[model samples]
Target: MGGFTLDDILATRKPRDSWWTVFMVDPLACRLALLVANHTSITPNALTRLSMLIGFASAAAFTEGMLVAGAVLFYLSFTVDCMDGKIARLKGTGTPFGLWLDYVGDRVRVVCCAFGWGFGEYTRTGDTDVVLAAVGVVVLDLFRYINGPQLKRVKDATRALLETRLEGQYVLAESVLRSRPRSELEQAAAEFEQTAEDTGATVVDLQKAFHARFPWYDRFRVFLVRHRVRTHVVSGIEFHAAVFVVAPLFGAAALVPVAAVAGTLLLTFEMFLVYRVWLASRQVPRTAAEREKILV
Candidate 1:
C-alpha cells in the first residue's frame, strides 16, 4: 500500500491536472518530487506526519511571540505539506488511507495555526478575541469537512447528467441521418427537428417559469452566483502568508487580530461554497432505478 508509486495512481485514471492541483502548483513540482521519492525510502505518510510535527513547532514558536521563528517554521511546514502528496503520487503509494491522512493533517495544521495566533496574542496583549477567532476558524474548518462527501456526490451527478444528455442527443441525430428509406429519413428528420425545437422551447420556457415562480432559485446556481466570490476568498489564504512574512515590519500586536479575522472569514466562505455546491447537487436528478431502490 505505502510502497506504491505515482504511476499506480495514474493507472487509476485520475486527472493529472485539476483546478485544485493547479492552484497548489503541483504540476510544476511533480517531476522534482517524483525524483526525490524514487531515490528515498521515505513513505508519504511519514512525510505527512513530519509536516504535522513542523506545524506544531511553528505554532509553538508563534505562541511564544517568536515571530521570526514561527514564520520560518510555518513556511517549512507548508513546503512539507506540498511535498507529501507529490511524493505519494511519485512513489505510487497514494492509497485511500494516505489521502485521508493528508486531508486530516491539513485540517489539523490550520487549527494549530489558529491556536498559535491566539497564543501569540495572549503573549503580547492577553486578548481573548484572538482565541475566540481561532475557535471560529476551527468550526468553519469542520463545516468544510462535513460537506465534502455531499459536494463530491453533487459534482459527480452533474457530470453524469451532462454526459448522458449530450450522448442521447448525438445518437438520436445520427439515427435520423442514417435512416433507410428517403421518406423514413425525412420523417425521422421531421421528428428530430421537432425534438430539437421542443427541447429548446422547453428549456427556455422552464427558465422563464422557474424565474417567475422561484426568483430566488438563481441563488442556487453555484457557479453563476458563488464561484467568483469563493475563488477570491480562497485566494486570500496567500494574504495570511504575506502577513506572516511582514509581521516584523509591523510591531503592533493589532495585526494579529486582523489576520485572525481574515483567516476566520476565509474559512467561513470556503465552507459556504462547499454547502452551496452540496445544495446545488441535491437539485440534480438521479437514475430512476436508483431512485426506486431507495427505501423511502
Candidate 2:
C-alpha cells in the first residue's frame, strides 16, 4: 500500500488558491504534519470534508444567534479551509477530483451561510437583509459559474507562456555552461543574455500592443483578472454581511442605506468584471492567432 506524503500534495501550483492562505492561522502546520508522517500518508480530501463540517457548524451558530461563538467558528472554518490545500500538498494526493470538490465545497459553504443568515434574520426581526444576502450569494455563484471556464483557460494560457519562457532561458543557460571553447562560450553567454532580455522585452511589448488595441477595455480587464481567491467585490459583500449582523443588534435604521450602498457597489463591480471578461474572450482569438506565428 502506497501512502501519500504531504509534500507530494503541496507540489500542485494553484495560483487561485493563494487567497485562502491568508486566512490561515498556522500556515506551517501542514508542512509539520508532512514531516511527522514521513511523507507516507493522509489525504487533502479529508481535511476538505472537515473544513466543510466546521463551516456548517459556524453557519448554524450564526443562525442560532450565538454571535461570538459563530464568529469564532467561522474563523475556524476559514482556517480549516486554508489547511485542506496545504494538507493536499503535503500528502501528494491533489487530484482533479479533489480540486473540483474543494471548489464546489466553497460555493456550498457560501450559499448555506447566506441562507442561514437570512433564515436567522427572518425569525428574529422579520428583516429582509437575510433574503437580500441570499440573492447576493446566488448572484456571486452565478458570476463564478459563468466566468469559471474562461478564467481557467486564461490561467492555463498564462502558465504555458511563463513555462515556455523559463524553458528557453534554461536551455540558453545550459549551452553557455557547457562550452568547449572559452571565447565561444563567452560569446554564446552574451547572446543568451540578449535573448533573455529580448524575450522579456517582447512580453512587455505584447502587453503594450494588447493595451493599445483594446485601450478602452484594458484597465477593466486588468481589474477583473483575479488569479487568486482575493475578490474586489467580496469586500463589499462582507460589508453588507456586517451590516446585516449589526443592524439587529443596534436597532439602527441607518444601516439600510449602508447596506444599499454596499450592495450596489458589489453588484456594479461584479457586472463590470463580467462584462470585461466577455470582452477579453472576444479578443482572444485574434490575440491567439497573432501569438501563434510569433511563438512558432
Candidate 3:
C-alpha cells in the first residue's frame, strides 16, 4: 500500500512484544493505516478516538443481541487501535495525554462491552448469572490496572538490580505499556531509580536480600506476568477474534460467557499462583553457599 514496504510499516509499530499483534493482526492493519496516513489528513489521536467510538458501537450492538455485528465492530475498533500506534510512531506525535486517553478509553470500552453483553443475555434468557459474569469481567480487568504498577515496580527493581550488578551502573529507562505513553513511563522510572540510589543500598546486595527473603516470588511473578503464558491468558487479539469471529458461528449466547470464562479462568489461575508464590516466598533463606549454587 502506498510506497510503504513491510519493513517500513513494521517500523511504525510502537512496541513489538505481543505475539498476536506481531504475528497476525498488526502488520496488515498497520500497512493499511500507513497508506491512509500517506494519503489523508487523519491523525493518530483521531484514530484512537475513532476506535473508542467503534468500541462503544460494538457494545451497543452486543446489547441488541446482534453478536456478529458487535464482533465485527470490535474488530474494526481493534484494527483502528493498532493503526493509532503505528500512526503515532510514524508521525512522532505521541503524547502522555494521548496515552492516558487511550488507556482510559480501552478500559471503558471493555466494561461497557461486558455490560452490554450481560444486558443482552438478560433480555434473552433472564439469567442473572451472566450479569454477574459481566461484573467479573470488569473486576478482572480493573485488577490489572490496580496491580499492574506494583508488579511493574517489582520487575523494574529486579531488572535494575540485575543490570546494576552485571554492569556496575543503573540506567533509567521506560518499559512500554500498551496504552500508556513512554514519556510518562520514563519519568516514573527516573523517580524510582533515584529513590533506589538514595537509599544507599547497592542494587545487587538489596536484590539478593530481597530474593533471599522472598524466594519464589520473583520466579513466579516473572513467569506469570511477562512470558508466553501471560500473552495467551490475557485477551487481546485472541479474545476479540474468538468473540467476534468464532463464537457467532456457534450462536450469540456463547459470546459474553466465552469471554468471561476465559478471563475468569486466567485470573483465578493467577490468583492461585500468587498465593503459592507468596507462601514459598515466606520460607527461611538458604545459606550463602546454597544461594551461590542456585544463582550459578
Largest lDDT belongs to which candidate? 3
Clashes of each: 8, 13, 0
For each candidate, the alpha-carbon lDDT, in order, equals 0.56, 0.53, 0.63
Minimum summed lDDT over a 10-residue window in model 1 is located at: 201-210
Over 4 Å off in model 3, which ranges?
1-4, 160-249, 268-296
**For model 2, what is the C-alpha lDDT against the true structure?**
0.53
**TM-score, structure 2 vs. true:** 0.57
For all predicted structures, in order, the TM-scores are: 0.57, 0.57, 0.66
What order do candidates take by TM-score, descending? 3, 1, 2
1-296: candidate 3 lDDT, tens digit per residue: 24555676677664334455655667578777867667876777888899999999988988998878887887778788888777777667677688988888888888888788778878889888778877876787777566666555544444543453455454323122223333254455555667777544322223333345566655554544443234334444454456444564466667566866567665665565455334333332445554464333
Candidate 2 wrong stretches, greater than 4 Å: 1-20, 23-42, 153-206, 209-296
Looking at candidate 1, what is the lDDT of residue 212? 48
Q: Which stretches of candidate 1 lie over 4 Å from their true place?
A: 1-35, 156-257, 264-296
Quality of model 3 by C-alpha lDDT: 0.63
Q: Which is superior by TM-score, 2 or 3?
A: 3
Give the TM-score comparing model 3 with the true structure, all chains together. 0.66
Question: In TM-score terms, which candidate is top?
Answer: 3
